[model samples]
Target chain A: MTETASLRRAARRYRLEFGGAMAAYALTVLGTSLWIDANPGSSARLPVALLPVIPVVLVVVAAVRFFRSQDELLRRRQVEALAFAFVGTALAVITYGFFETVGFPRLSAWWTWGTMAILWCVGTFVSSRRYG
Target chain B: MKNLLRVLRTERGWSQLDLAEQLGVSRQTVNALETERYDPSLPLAMRIARLFERPVESLFFLDEDAT
Candidate 1:
């Protein structure tokens, strides 16, 4: 198959796998939350809370597979974007941590992941423009 | 690095997309190569040379200042 066809197939597969994994994560989170709420102080609460991580692992696997499928230029772009996101997220979190020490409201650790994800998109866009 | 990619590609009457298709890369990559915004990997450079029926040295060269 042509590179274009192979790329399209990889993209489609990634979308399907990522979408399915996210759906599963959402369902697991909802189920676990409800179960915990209904049975306060249950021994299984810790395990149930961690259940969502399984689907998240699958999502990460799907992402890695998609990255591997891309050509050299695209792989370089992805590496640059990921580097940008990694560094940007670190700086942001550290800055935010300093603010929290100086009377700002404390934030959840989940915000770090959210910030990284947003920066990843921004980095990808910036890298795309750089190449174009 | 400087390359005669644009000149060679136009000489063959191939659009960026057509060349990208032939090279098995995205059109943006082809555009980057033509504009000298990106340098291709050695393998990609070899592939381009093979496709154009030219030696790699004939297709690409260092800028005079770099020599």
Candidate 2:
């Protein structure tokens, strides 16, 4: 198969895995929320809170698989993209830290992950365009 | 570094995808090589040269400015 075809197939599989993860995440969130509502002071809160991470791990695994399946050139592009995203996110977090010190409201930890994901997407697009 | 990848591929009447398939690489790799955006490894360069039935030196060359 052509590299593009292989990549597309890998992408399709990743998408399916991602979809499954998202579905599981949604269900876990719903279940946790309902359980929390029913038992506002339950001892199971800690475990419930961690349930969503199960699907997240699956998503991460799918990402690793996708990365492993890429050709060397594509892998290099991804490495560049990841480096860009890492540096960008670091700078953003540092800037946010400065803002926090100046009395800005502290954001959730998930915002960091969200920033990385956004920057990674941007980096991938930029890098691909640069190479293309 | 510079190479006549585009010229060679054109001479062979091969699309990037066709060349990539023969090279066991992605079309993007072929495109990157043609555009000089990325350099192939020695082994990959040799594979490309072999595919085109040319010496590696004939297929690729260093730019004077690059030195």
Using lDDT, give the best candidate's number: 1
The CAPRI classification for model 2 reads as medium
Model 1: per-residue lDDT, tens digit, A8-118? 788999999999999999999999999999989789889989999999999999999999988888999999999999999999999998998989999999999999999
Residue-by-residue lDDT tens digits, candidate 2, A41-118 = 889888988899999899899989989988788898899999999999999999999999989999999999999999
Off by over 4 Å in 1: A1-3, B65-67
CA displacement after TM-score superposition, residue B65 of candidate 2 (Å): 8.5
Which pairs in model 1 have colliding backbones?
Answer: none
- The two-chain DockQ for each candidate, comma-separated, is 0.45, 0.58
lDDT, residue A42, candidate 2:
86
